[model samples]
Target: MPETTAASSRTGRLLAAPLALILSVGSLTACGPTDDGPHADGTRPSSVTSPSVTSPSASGPSAPGAPSVPAAGKTAGTGPTTRHTASSSPAAGRDPDDPDDRLHQWMESGSIPMNASYHWPMLDTSARLADGEKFLFEEHCGARRTPETDSLARAAWMEKARPGKNDGDQNWLAQETIAAHLQDGKRKASALFGGLAKELQACGSAHTSVTYTTRDSRHVAATIVLDKDTARPTTLHEYLAVVGDNVLELSLWATPYHQDGGNKPDVAWPGPPDTSVFQAMTTPVCPQGKQC
Candidate 1:
């Protein structure tokens, strides 16, 4: 086969699997008809592509010392609170329900419409965050956009290898499916992305107040964190963007300390690159900006 054809064929499997998990939440449960939202004609341009999937780089569980989940209802950020941020007011229009947009693709399949750094089996272990981190992830975890958020609908997720069972990959997975309230043709999805950025910031900030010794830095489009102090050193990165009435967010966590070969891995911390998670979130622009 020609090089171009062969390359496409090789990547096909990487893009097709793992879609089931992203779209499993079948109910459109929270949206109403568009009164003053999206295009006046109720139409959006066709999307050139749909949501794609990226397999993990082989998996295991949580970080080195992340504690197991405690009994339900015992965690931080437990109650809902009215929160505000700069330029984060959600619009009042309904997001357009286009079947071909990236949001729809994600809704149809529980998958991140992007390829992972490498493909590997999903780690069979359960989520395990440190005592404080666990509370933050299971409870304060900002992926779950709150009711105060201007989102009419949303889906959030994270995938990681069990720290002990993992095969030494340096990444995990995270995703959020957000449907924003649109108004006057603009989807105002940016507010949703902004909201998520704020949540992650809050999460990172909480890290300092807690006992976890995670090290982190921010990139233009995403944030990267390293946890070498744990039994298994892990790396995590994520990015978020708004598309029409939808916001796509992706995060990846990995553990490569086994390869570093030391109690404190000597590998130099590298800035997170523009991974497919970044590319997928940035792509899929609708002319009206709210239809996706």
Candidate 2:
């Protein structure tokens, strides 16, 4: 999730690159805390390094074809909007209740939960970036490609829990999720979740470690601590679950650091929230053979 901008200085770029990836995916709008405590700003530094999450051929952020990064204190572009419309008609002689067709329709508009989970605020697609409603095939963590999920229907959503005023200090929680249909869901879920876990493990000097994990037939969740070699390290949580042929993914990123305080940030985070909350959230989206 590295940003895609040239930095004024190498140190600035190095300092910014590690933090840009996920922030770039967000609004990058910096704001001040409305309350009395240290807050984390969901903004990106001026410089960016675009680690190609979708393509491996391209070198790191410095390579050509990297998207341009916005200047410091500016909002990151949300890319083009994409609308996913389920097929209106089924093939001739095919049952109207066809699982694939139902899956497609459910994935296009029915999987995400709008309610808050694990202390995170309610998620709103409208409150996200410009193209927040779009369905995405790309992975947030730098994964080469999701195995066995090509050409499948997918849905994605992202939102910030608390967007404070534009006063340069802020504390926010960023969250996103993806739902898709797979032929071999169990295998596909493992492949998808495994790829993400592998990529996240490479973060930081000692690399991020799995602080907690839960695995069952219905879902798998893992929380990792991204102690990157920077002034502020982030805590990222990811969850993956399978219900029949449907697979769902949820991710959360939060870092509480203030601009004025520099290296010393307030340790007020409520620890990594449980990702299992999404396991139940996925059932209603793609339950059994019924369309949601």
Q: Which candidate gets the maximum TM-score versus the true structure?
A: 2
lDDT of 2 by residue, 125-152 (tens): 2233211222221333333444332223
| Ten-residue region with minimum lDDT total, candidate 2 | 155-164
Question: Over 4 Å off in model 1, which ranges?
Answer: 1-147, 150-188, 206-220, 226-233, 256-277, 285-292
Q: lDDT at 220 for candidate 1?
A: 25
- Residues 91-178, candidate 1, lDDT per residue (tens digit)? 2121223222112223211124223333333222222211111111323343445564423232211112222222344334443333
Reference-based TM-score of each model: 0.36, 0.40
Candidate topping lDDT: 2
**Which lDDT value does model 2 have at 82?**
16
lDDT of each: 0.38, 0.42
True-structure lDDT of candidate 1: 0.38
